[model samples]
Target: MIPAGSGGRNRPIEHASFYAALPLIDDFERLSDTANFTALPEDWLIGVSDIEGSTAEIAKGRYKAVNMVGAAVISAQMNAMDGQPFPFVFGGDGATFAIWPEQARAAADAMRAVQRWALDEYGITLRAALVPVRDIRAAGLRIAVARYRVSDGVDYAMFHGGGASWAEQALKDGIYGFDPAPSGVRPDLTGLSCRWAPQSARNDMILSLVVVPVPGASARLYAQVAAEIVTLAQTLDRGGHPVPRDGPAMQWPPEGVALEARAQRRSGTLLRQRAGILFQTFMAWLLTRTGWTVGGFDARRYNRAVAGNSDFRKWDDGLKMTLDCDNETSKRIEALLAHYHDRGILRYGLHRQDSAIMTCIVPSIMRNDHIHFVDGAAGGYTAAATAMKVQG
Candidate 1:
């Protein structure tokens, strides 16, 4: 959910202009229809953050930390906007956000903050980069975008074309790195958390996948693959959505986790980190139990909102999903994907794990909404991405 304005009148002037300048689609159903998306403005800026060596980190049993840091990049940028509207998509290992030219500085600062946080707190390198939209176009690539209305006060951006991918590659190639914030300059990681236990595989396995159309692939073919994924999700996963939405409920004296390492704030010291965890644990109990009203906070309603805002399957330049299905179903899906891959229609990566992990951001859940992001617990998007690279 977008935060409320940083201030009534002091909110950045570019906020309104940037959102007003774009074309938005209110219908989520139409997102699958390729005709609905439009080319992004040439004057905008594309910013991205991806954790280097994410697969290794996941292998080290730090998947939760990886997921948390990845989501933190998006959360940090959203907070920087101070309630302004922008287009962003969460990747399993990082996030990509687009901003108006006027907001580039703020966006850059936010990225730097997240980069510093990732390195200092998680001991992972978060590489962030920003490139001009025009430069991308000059390289013969485009950023196509559309907005999907999920629920009241919740909207997500869908991206098409290969521009975002190209930009990410540039970052990886050391062509677009941003100057990070000063040492100890932490990003506002206030809303990040991982409160739920890992979700067990429903039938046999949870498949972490990334499917990208081959270079020069026709839009019609890509759309066909996209539609097929939706059909498979419905036909296989008991129609419960490819991404499940089971999180901690609003119970009193909420269950506390033995380890809070994955959900600590990055702005504080060791003592403060422990204190922050205790405070959040206590707050979870107090807020959900007593139903205490503070700053328009309502734990019960927030819990409901959390369940509603699950982002299990996301679309950016390609499709990324954490699907819950048995072995047979997964094989069938893979066969279809392989059929397409062999035809040079698309490239894909598939990895299986026994559970799914979630990271969340609940900023005033009563006001806006709470969103939970899920990925396969072991390997997940990172491993899937690795497999996809090898396939390519």
Candidate 2:
């Protein structure tokens, strides 16, 4: 949803390059096999992880990308076992394998252990966080197992944690990994359901979430979230933000977002932080006004928040990114739109975490540069429609 050229013909050359010079990372591709994205694992504890700031973290620190990946791999295998006797697999950065659930817990414990090792061992600023399919916990992380069946594949539970993911999002923000995507795809975040708030971004009723669904349990919650998007479109249409609806195909803009099958303003960004930060910031601001601050965030509170925050929490789930996405690729494209917009002037192209062709893009929106827009998104977009303005 671009403003059609922040600097039209009247803009200068450098201003014109503001977008043209925008850095673009490799296209993010998530889920390829025509097989349905399901979960079918037999007595396997799946730990999903990805090297977040491996590039920068390595450059600034001593750890390399491979080191980070290896750490995640080792951690996944450890957590899956949970000290039990079973086999395990570390599916790269976004995932890992475990021999037993007991070993899996060990992996989660290693989150702090590994980071401490990185910091102490190699002078690297790396962190690891793990989760379990059942009974998972970490100091400041969200843990959930998404149970899904992929096409003919058996059921498998994907362990989701927050620290590494948050780091991944951060690394992505340092670059522009999301761009060049058409606004038709919508990815299902239900797989990444159990959520938590970043200690740095905590505010009122909102907690930064990891957001991986319990695999098969995302249907109702997904639908519930979709409802919130509908209401949002109605509100935007009334607010004069050009809700260009194309047709009966995609549910964007409610009426004017999709023009003849083309998305009017492409949206969706890895700027989960941008949206997260913006809204969370507002939450902090609002709650502060009313004496509200994030509580301890019990496990049940975290799970329920992901499933039933209504609009309050549901809205934070990045629902619009799924506007017209009927499959995975399209969803990536739409998500790219968000990835781009949220990046703002300082684009951050963070490729989809699970894409085969991994890449990242982030533009630096200097703090000293944009005074009025400091609280805005990274690139130049803001997903917080109501949060900032609703500060009563």
For all candidates, the clash counts are: 0, 107
Off by over 4 Å in 1: 1-29, 237-268, 282-300
Tens-place lDDT digits, model 2, residues 21-55: 32221111111111212222232233333444444
lDDT minimum window of 10 residues, candidate 1: 250-259
Tell me the TM-score of each prediction against the true structure: 0.87, 0.26
Query: What RMSD, rounded to one decimal, does every model reach?
Result: 3.4, 23.7
* Pairs of residues clashing in candidate 1: none
lDDT of 2 at 263: 11
- TM-score between model 2 and native: 0.26
Q: Candidate 1 lDDT, tens digit per residue, 1-392? A: 35335442354455445554455565443566768777887888888888899888887988878888889888888778766767888888898888877677888888998888778767889999888889899999878887765556576777888899999999999999976688878787667776666777768888888998888887788778777876777676444343434334333222223224434544445667666666776786677677786777676667656655677776788888777887777887899999999988899999998887777776754565667777888888889989999988
Highest lDDT, which number? 1
Cα lDDT of candidate 2 equals 0.26
Model 2 C-alpha RMSD vs. true structure (Å) is 23.7
